[model samples]
Target: MWRCKMVDLLIRILPVSAWKDRLIQWHVPGCAACSEKLAAREEAMSVLVQERELVSVKDFWPVVNRRLRSGVEREAPPSRPAWQWVSVAAGLAVVILTSLWLNRAPFEEASADLTQKLQIDYIRIGDEPARAYVFQPKGVNMTLVWIEKDGEGE
Candidate 1:
């Protein structure tokens, strides 16, 4: 299968040399697959040659040059009106100013009373027999909790 694929690729990409012709002559006759592939490739190449013959080489360059010359004469796109741009800029400025005014004080200052910030009414214990101890060490703004099951000894 790989050999068949390699021959297909070589048929298209290989240069038109005597070595390629000799290879096809020697190998294609022995393999029906190779012979079929060669016939198909030759038929395709002949079709391509026929299509190529329809386009005269002498006329190709002049047609391309004429198109390029006409392309240069095409008008440029019209510019957008100045007032539309000014109104768009004004609208964006109004949106930015409104957002800034609304978010001027995003966060309010904390209350002076510390009790209002950290309030604890009461702690509830579950049905399991356990002891809970809460500690707020001095000089630190944090609290620590410790729980001990009734049956466990430390």
Candidate 2:
């Protein structure tokens, strides 16, 4: 199938002086299918060439410009208006700001409460001495014997 198409293409494109023309002519006589395909392709090409309208070079630019303008008119409107773009941006900004403003107070309160708790824990751990001596070593066994001294564990 491909050989027939290739031979048809070479016969159409190659000049008379090309050696491939003689080769194709030799092959076409032996191959009945290739000869038939080449005949059909040549007939189709001749009909197409004869039916095609030849445009003058002077009239070509006007036709091209008219078609281009018509195509532009048929297409959708180019870009959105500038004001529409600005309004969309403003809307997105307002939504983002409102969400941040609504959440600001709780976030601040949580941060302050965490700071206070951490400070209180630090103070209690540093100032309390009885919390440290609750564990005592007694002959290879650990014991929690609290001996109360005055002003201690108060």
Question: How do the residues 15-81 of candidate 2 rate in per-residue lDDT, one tens digit apiece?
Answer: 7756676867677888988666455766777778453465643657788889887896576664668
Using TM-score as the measure, which candidate wins? 2
Model 2 gets an lDDT of 0.64
Question: What are the lDDT scores of the predictions, listed in order?
Answer: 0.67, 0.64
In model 2, the Cα lDDT at residue 42 comes to: 67
- Model 1: clashing residue pairs? none
The residue pairs found clashing in candidate 2 are none
| Best by the lDDT measure | 1
Can you give the TM-score per candidate against the true fold? 0.23, 0.25
The deviation in Å at residue 13 for candidate 2 is: 90
What TM-score should be assigned to candidate 2? 0.25
